[model samples]
Target: MAAKMKGAQILVECLKREGVEVAFGIPGGANLPTFDALYNSPIKVILTAHEQGAAHMADGYARATGKVGVCLATSGPGATNLVTGIATAFMDSIPVVAITGQVRTSVIGNDAFQEADTIGITRPITKHSYLVKDVRDMARVVREAFYIASTGRPGPVLIDLPVDSTVAETEFIYPEQINIRGYRIQASPLIDRAAIHRAAEAIAQSKQPIIYAGAGVIHGTAFAELLELAHKTHIPVTTSLLGLGGFPETDSLSLGMLGMHGFEYTNYAVAQCDLLIGIGARFDDRVTGKPDEFARRAKKIHVDVDPSSINKTVVVDYPIIGDVKQVLQELNRIVQAPDTRAWLATIQKMRQEYPLLYREKEKLLPQFIIQEISELTKGNAVVATGVGQHQMWTAQFYQFNRPRSMITSGGLGTMGFGLPAAIGAQFGRPDAVVWDIDGDGSFQMTTQELATASKHKLPIKVAIMNNQHHGMVRQWQDLFYQGRHAQSEINPVDFVRLAEAYGCVGIRVEKKDDVRPAIERAMAITDRPTVMDFVVEETEDCWPMIAPGKPHDQMLGTYETLKQAGGVPQHRRSDPDEEAKLSLG
Candidate 1:
């Protein structure tokens, strides 16, 4: 049975069938028909301040809720605005379906107003793309877009719907199942049993085994499985930036984050481990740090759903391609605990020697603010961040105890991602407390979203680490550019006034004692959004940095105590490599 309906109506019906509760976007002339269809629908539409914000909002919703997030835009500029957000999702493997309105099918290529090659432009960034030319194809395209976006590695998908198709009538028959040729997702039962056994054997045999987890664990909903495997094996765990909440940081076996700005001991563990079990983790350059030297002594076993990711970067001894949760389940059934008492002792010693620390200055520090927020929230809030020094500080300081708790721009490092992302996260988890720990530079990038938050009366708290300059850029200039200030210095703005103008509560804290009170005030306000601008020390830099192309063991700024006490392991101490000569300051 089929019902004749306009293409736009059919598209909304398809969305309803897919169980979409909400969408984020702004309406434009080309998408008027689709907007009209949405007007009478059950789904709620969040009209964003900008298309880019809409895309990030969708991404944030997906990351927070583990659902395929949806966003809509018109052709040309509206479509172009989504590029950065789409790319961010693609890089981080967030599931998002971006629908764009194109010109009429008759005038698509004839220099029509607001027409752009949406499909061609987004092909590289999207997992898949479609241009619906006929009303009959509208339902199928929407179905395929959602299917592709939510399956496999899970990335963004784009559908460019021509305006004429929205007006055209079609016999709508939403497909109950999708069967795309040459497209197959590796299901749990189909996982290779032999590889799972082999990986288990390797884990059991290793004396110093480490579980290097990534965002894949979160995406595959395998945090419990990952926990089971680690506890069963008695192996220590270290995660990539995006992998923070995949394992509880409070666990004794946890090594926190292990990368550029990761804990000093976590990097040491990576250097010393004999077996590296990378479950749902890509050995990214950020984590690997000088590929040849990364885990030089460790035999690697990589488990991923995508086959191409295996041997795509650093080659591994055992490659198992399967869903992370399923693979971990199989491994847990047969895996035996290794004798890791001595290894754990060594890591504990390292942890004690080089704990994350910042100088106790008279001026407020970003690390203290993050720790305060973590304590005030009881480590149970959904925290999002924009890229820069503040981002790393949050990663270093915030104690994440649950999955999907830390939303950030990891692979893409997109500035201005926090405000919109926080707004989206609030929508996805309406009851959960959401906070955006953003740098001043990053906050200014998408501060306009504050209006959107106020419009919806979403109670998302924002803490701005106002360092008066592009903190990370300034740090790099100090280290590599001979201390030239360059143009990193940003002129100050009254964020308090700006927030009030957006119809939100605003607070500013400039002293050490004012930090906690300001945060408490913001936290108390649950009726609407709140912004706290803490004017921090201008020259404070994120420490324990591993310079580019340097080995993780050659990290700079291992607090003076480690040097004076000679507590750093002999092997883990920085060698006199040329790069090591770079200033620790």
Candidate 2:
């Protein structure tokens, strides 16, 4: 332990102890002392274009590597700018440690220059927050923040250090173990035999079963356990948006994403299953459109580390609260494979009958572009996305085979998250090919980060699907608003010029023939990030659609979708047995 160390020096040392190799942030007046300390530290600090970008980059790094990402910022607006990024991480359960500089402790209430109530401002968004008043507590605070951020049900934790304390000398002693009284960091790894037995009994009795997985499985590194359980039971799997890559999408049991814009058969399987085993998944409202109608026939067994998420949305007949990997290990040990050939046959029939379809087009389609990218990458890339149509396309088409291969803002659905996130992903996994699949509007929001990546020589690939409008909102208008375009349209910017301005090589892929060659060229460039502007069909809609205010089964894709809404053909609704099936009894 150092006999005398400044608060800033202590913070840097604590970060080194936490094994943080790289952090993202922009330094300002209030955080200068901390930045000065960072200069002499072993950890590499990436100065971003903006604080929001820094927060998102940290989140991306954390999500990509399954490590607690670190970010730094100054007071007032600098701290405030991090609110959106923090909220995004909190919503998605990404682990991050956000450090912000504050005003002097004496003038905190007086609103000194660049002063802000950082802890209070970020309180709602963070898993935990602290306002450091004493220099002696600096090391302990940093250790605690990392501990909380990376523990069970990980999310962002914030620590606000006053500028006064940053320069104050203190005896440095890092805490070996945290003793937060009310917090339980680890769920008991001991298998509950009774719970395992009950779950096994339920599975044994179930004629039809479906596994609904989410991001927690990936966070817990329980994909192997999940896969084993699925294979042993011969059950099919459907994942939430964030859960992409948690299961091998190329597997026969895999049913891609199950929510709005999900596969028709996947939604049907979820709705019709006698037992829906939700592994590390919350029944999010987005996943369960018309909550009462979602998976009504299923007797759900929900497994999650967070107790609050269980039974919060859809009803659960059985709740298992523990680490996903641990719980899954127990379930796999006790449960035997049931004869689900008949149920699987029915699902396979549905899958073949009503597969996802898109019209062949002469104009370049965003879906086609994304699908091609997936094929080229072969599910090996660390793919990130900005929210909107592009995000959905990436989620649907890309076959994510490994954990941490797919990164997106699932819960918050933040626009402008892709480019910066890809930068972070590239930083964390430099050997992996990192792609930012982005929509024009979303890309425009955080495109300035291109400079940061370019300056740092991060060779990330950015593919912008330029649709000339806010495509998701436009799709909504096209569907429900009598063809009124309304205010969904936005001005188009020349993305090639924009990329060049940021010192990045820009490729324009307007024709189908150019797309592959352009991608190859971009992949070959290892010196700096590459941007590709794909001007896609202006109003192309994402298919396998579940319209708003409708059940997941009420899909509208092809003419086949109209054939059945409630299990029976639309024309055979009056049939007594078919009607019974429709009633979901």
Candidate 3:
């Protein structure tokens, strides 16, 4: 049945059909008609203070709920403001759809107010983009946008609607099927059985095998399959930063995280493994210190849906291009547990030798704060973080037992992502506890979103590690730049009062003893948002860092710590050849 309606009305109706229960955005002259249509619709609209915050909120919602998140904005400045957030989602492969309202079609090129090339600006960051000049094309574009955003290698999609199109009248008929030429989602069942068998054979032959999983494991919903494959094969597991919760960190085989700042023993295990099974993980530079030196002794097997990712960095012996879950399912059926007794013993020894530890001081520490949160929440809360020292600390200390429990800007390392992401996570899982463990420098970037959280009464607890400096930047300068403290030092702001101004509860803790009580009080507030300022040591650095371009085994902080603790192994003090021999055996 066809009925006459404005394009704005059709847009709202199409969103309803796509199961969009909530949208985040702001209104302007170009988007007023869409806002007017939303006024009468059943969908909940959250008015964000800025367009960037709205985009991040949508990203957070999608990551938390595994749904295609939606955000709207006007064409010019509004569309431009979403660039950083869109890039964040694209780098991390989060499914989000951003809609922007443009000027009238006739005035699009006339330099009219609030007119920008929305499609041109967003093409690089989005999976697909559309511009709707005709009112009748609204339904099809919306359908395609959602489809593209949520499909294979999920990323963001953009839809640009002109003001004239929104006001124009047309008979609406939403498409029941999508028929985009040259666009195909790889079927999960069409896996190569021969390749799976070959991978299984390789697994059987290897003495020390490591499973390096990534966000794709979570995105493909292969958590159970990954666990089964690991358990069946008795392989130790390490993950990229975004892949933290793909395998339970509390498991015996779990190696926390493996990267530049990963656990010292995880990197050592990766260095000495005979076989590397990469599941949905790209060999990012952070994870693979020097690509040529990464897993030099290991035969690599990479499994991913995107074919281009295979051998894009480190060459692989066996590349299986299929869904992670499907490939793992088939592999689990044929795989047998390898004799990794010696390998597990070696890894356990390394773990015991170089554990994650920080100096106990009278002043508060970020690591202690994160440990408290993880203990209080039983490692079940949806933990979000901004990029910095705090982000790495959360990845290291927090025990994530489930997927989608850790949300952050991994690929882009975008600052100011924590608070808005927490807001979105709270909305997606209303009954669950959400925490934003943020740094002072990163939190100040998008701290205005506290208003949105307060207005909605989202019980998202924010723990600010107020170190009064750009912690990571300071660390780098200290290590690489002769301790010249540049503009990294941040002026102190009263975060407690700031939280109060936003209509939320605020608490500040200055001593180590107050950390647990502050967290407990924040946890007690179940109505509105609560911000806690824990003034931590200003000069602490994230340890066990592998300098850029260095091999994974050549970690800096661990050797010093181990030497100080009188636990430095005889092999660690030897040359690379001796270390490899000891680690390999």
Off by over 4 Å in 2: 189-191, 558-585
Candidate 3 per-residue lDDT over residues 487-520, each given as its tens digit? 9999999999999999999999998888888899
Q: Clashes in model 1: which pairs? A: none
Residue-pair clashes per candidate, as listed? 0, 0, 0
Better of 1 and 3 by lDDT: 3
TM-score of each: 0.96, 0.95, 0.96
lDDT of every model, 2 decimals = 0.89, 0.86, 0.90
TM-score of 2: 0.95
| Stretches of model 3 off by over 4 angstroms after superposition | 562-585
Give lDDT tens digits, candidate 1, residues 109-214: 8878888898888889999998889999998889998999998899999989899999899798878778899788999779999998998899889999899999
115-144 in candidate 2: lDDT tens per residue?
878888888999999999999889888998
